[model samples]
Target: MKPMKTSYFPIIALSAVIVVIIMAGLLLSDAALVVDFASKKQAPSLSHPFGTDAYGRDVLLRTLSGLSKSLLLGIAASVVSGILALVMGIIAGTAPKWVDNAINFIIDAIMSIPHLVLLILISFCLGKGLFGVVMGIICTHWTSLARVIRGEVLQLKEQQYIKIAQKLGQSPWTIAKTHLLPHIFPQFIVGIVLLFPHAILHESAITFLGFGLPPESPTIGIMLAESMDYVLSKLWWLFLPGVCLVAVVIVFDRLGKQLKARFDYDNMRG
Candidate 1:
C-alpha cells in the first residue's frame, strides 16, 4: 500500500480566509463608520448579521475593520522588531566582549519589565496614537529574537569553515553576509512570524486600556473597550469584535508554528 500523503489543505484554506478578511476589511473600513440612528442597538438578523451598535454602525463591518487594522499593525511592528533583532544580534555576536555584554544587559533589562506595563508607558509617553502603538510594540518585541540570532551567529562563528574563511583573508562583513546571514535566515523568518501574535495582542491590550489608539479609531481594542458598557445590557454583538480578535491571534500563532515545523523538517532533510 502507498504511504499517506501529507495534506496542506488546512493551511491553504486558513491563509486564504485571512487574505480575504484583510482585503475586505481594508476596502470597507470607511463604510463601517457610517452611523444610522434608526437602526441603533440592533440584534443579529438578516439585515445585519453581526447587528448594529449604539450609533447604528454595523458590528460586522466594524469588527472586520478592526481586525484588518490590527493585523496590519502586527505585520509592521513584527517586521521592524525582527530587523532590529537581526542587527543587534549580529553585533552582539561579532563585536567585542564589552559590546556583547552591553547588548545582553539591555536585553535582560527590557525582558525584566512587565511587557504590558512597558508597552503602556511607552505608548503613553509617545502621546497615544498609531505612531505610539507601533513604536511601543517595536521597542519591546525585539529582545527575544535578538538573543536567538546572537546565539546562532556565535555558534556559526566557531565552525571550522568560518575559521578557514577568516584565515584566508575574508572580511567579517563578507563572511557574515555569505554564511551567518544565510544560516540564520530560517530562524529570522520564524521569529518574525511568531512575533505577529504578540504584537497584535499587545497592541490590543494597550489600546483597550486607553493608551494606544485614539477612541475614535475603529480598532479591535477600542471596540472591545466600548463594548464594556453594553456588556451588562446583554448586547452580545458588541463583544463580537473581541472574539474575532482572539480568532485572528490564534490563527497567526498556528501559522507561525506551522512555518517553524516546516522549516525544521527542511533543515533536518538538508
Candidate 2:
C-alpha cells in the first residue's frame, strides 16, 4: 500500500526543520553563552529577551542551546532504542520457542522496574555524562517498542505469504529480511515517532535530578536543575527555561501523534 498524502506534511516538515533550526542556533550562539557581571539577574527585558542568568548570559540564547542539546539527546536515544527494538523483536518473533521465552523474560524483567529509578541507576553507574545518559535511555526505552514490533512480526508470521515462503524452502533469515521487515516498517516508524516525547521527557527528568549530563552542560535538564537555586529569588530564569522545555516537549508530542496518524496502515491504504 502506498502512503496516503495527509495534512500533516507541514507539521512533519516543521518538526524536522526544528532540529535543523536548533543545530543552527547552537552553532550561531557560541558567543551568547558568555557571562557578563553587569547584567546579572535581569528580568525579561527587550535587550535581553529571556532575561539574564546569574552569570548575566542571555537566557534566550542559553535556552535555545539547551533545547538543541535536549533534541540531540532525544534523537540519539530514540533511534538507538528503536534499532534495538527492531532487532530484538524480529529475533523473538521468528526464533524458536526457547529463544522467544528468553527474550520475553528479559523484557518482562526490564519493564518491571520503575522507569526513572532504572534510568538514574544506569546513568549513575555509567558516570552520568552524555554517553551515560544516552546509554541509560537506550537501554531502558527499547522494551515496549520491542514488544510492539514482536507482536507485529508474530501477526505477520501468520500471513499466507510467510507460510508459503517457509514451505517453499526459504530460509528464516531470508524471509525475515525480504518479507517480514517490509511488512513491519510502518509499525517501526510509528513506534520510533512515539518514542521521542518520552525520550525527551525522561532525559530532562534524569538530568534535572542530577543523574544525567554534567552541571556545566547546557542542556534543558541541567538548566532546569540549576534553576532551583534561584527560582525563589529570580523567577524569570526558571520560568523561561521551564516554559521552553514544556513547549518543546509539546511540539514533539504533537509531531509524534501526527506522524503516527500519517503512517497508520489503514490511513496509508486509504
Candidate 3:
C-alpha cells in the first residue's frame, strides 16, 4: 500500500495565518475604539489607515471585528453541518439498501434547488440577522458535503482491510470509529475548508440584501452599503472594504483548491 502524503505544510501555514487573524480580531477589544471624529472618511494614511466609517469608527478595526464575527459564525455553522454530513453519510453508506435510497433521495431533493436562493428564502423567513444567516448556510451547505462523505464511506466500507476487520470480530462501531473515520478525515478537513468561502460569500450577500448582520455592524456587506452614498465623491475609500472582502474570499478559495488537489493526488497514489 502507498503511504499517505502528510505534506500539508503549505495548507497548515495558510490556515495558521487565518487563525491568527481571527484570534487577533477576537482577543483585541480595543478594536472597537473610535480614535477620531475629524478623520471620518479619511483616506489610508499613517494616522488613519482604512479611513473611518460614517460614525467616525476606525474602519480597519471595524472590518477586523466584522471578520471575527463572520469567521466565528462560519466555523460554528460549518462544524454542525459537517457533523451532520458525516453521520448521515456513514449511515447511508453502511446501512441496508432502503436506508441508502431514502437518504440519497433527500439529499437530491435539497440539491435540486438553487442553493443561494434557498438560503435567502430561509434567512428571510427565519428573520433577518446573523442567526438567520447561520441557519441558512448550515441548512443548504451540507448537501455537497454529505455526498462527498457518502462516496468515501461507500468506497472504504468495501475495502479488504474493512472486511478483515469484520472477519477478525471487530465491532461495527469500532471499525467505523477507528478505521473508517481516520481514512476519511483528510477529506473531511478539506471539505470544511472548502465551505468557508461559500459561507463568507453567503453571509455577505445576506447582509447586502439588508437581511444579515445589523446595519451598525461593519460587515463587508454593511461597509459596501454604507459606502454607496459616498461612491461619487470618496471613490477609493468607499470601495476599499469591498475589495478586501473579495481578497479574503479569493484567498480561501485558492487555499481550498490547493489543499483539495494535494489530497486528491495523495488519494490516487494511495
Best by lDDT: 1
- Candidate 2, clashing residue pairs? none
lDDT per residue for candidate 2 within 1-270, as digits (tens), equals: 565555866776877777675786679567556889998888888898788878887778887887788877888889999999999999999999899999999999999999999999999999988888899999999999999999989999999999999999999989999998887887787778778778888988998898888877777787777778886784655567778778777777776676676767464475
lDDT of each: 0.91, 0.83, 0.80
What is the C-alpha local distance difference test score of candidate 1? Answer: 0.91
Q: Which stretches of candidate 2 lie over 4 Å from their true place?
A: 1-5, 265-270
Q: Per TM-score, what order, best first?
A: 1, 2, 3
Give the lowest summed-lDDT range of ten residues in model 2: 261-270
Superposed Cα deviation of residue 62, candidate 3 (Å):
1.5
The superposed Cα distance between candidate 2 and the true structure at residue 199, in angstroms, equals 1.5
Estimate candidate 3's RMSD in Å: 3.1
Model 3's lDDT to the true fold?
0.80
- RMSD score of candidate 1 (Å): 2.5
Give each prediction's root-mean-square deviation over alpha carbons.
2.5, 2.6, 3.1
Please give the lDDT score at residue 62 for candidate 2. Answer: 81
**Per-prediction TM-score, please?**
0.94, 0.92, 0.87
Rank by lDDT (best first): 1, 2, 3
Please report, as a residue range, the 10-residue window in candidate 1 with the lowest summed lDDT.
1-10
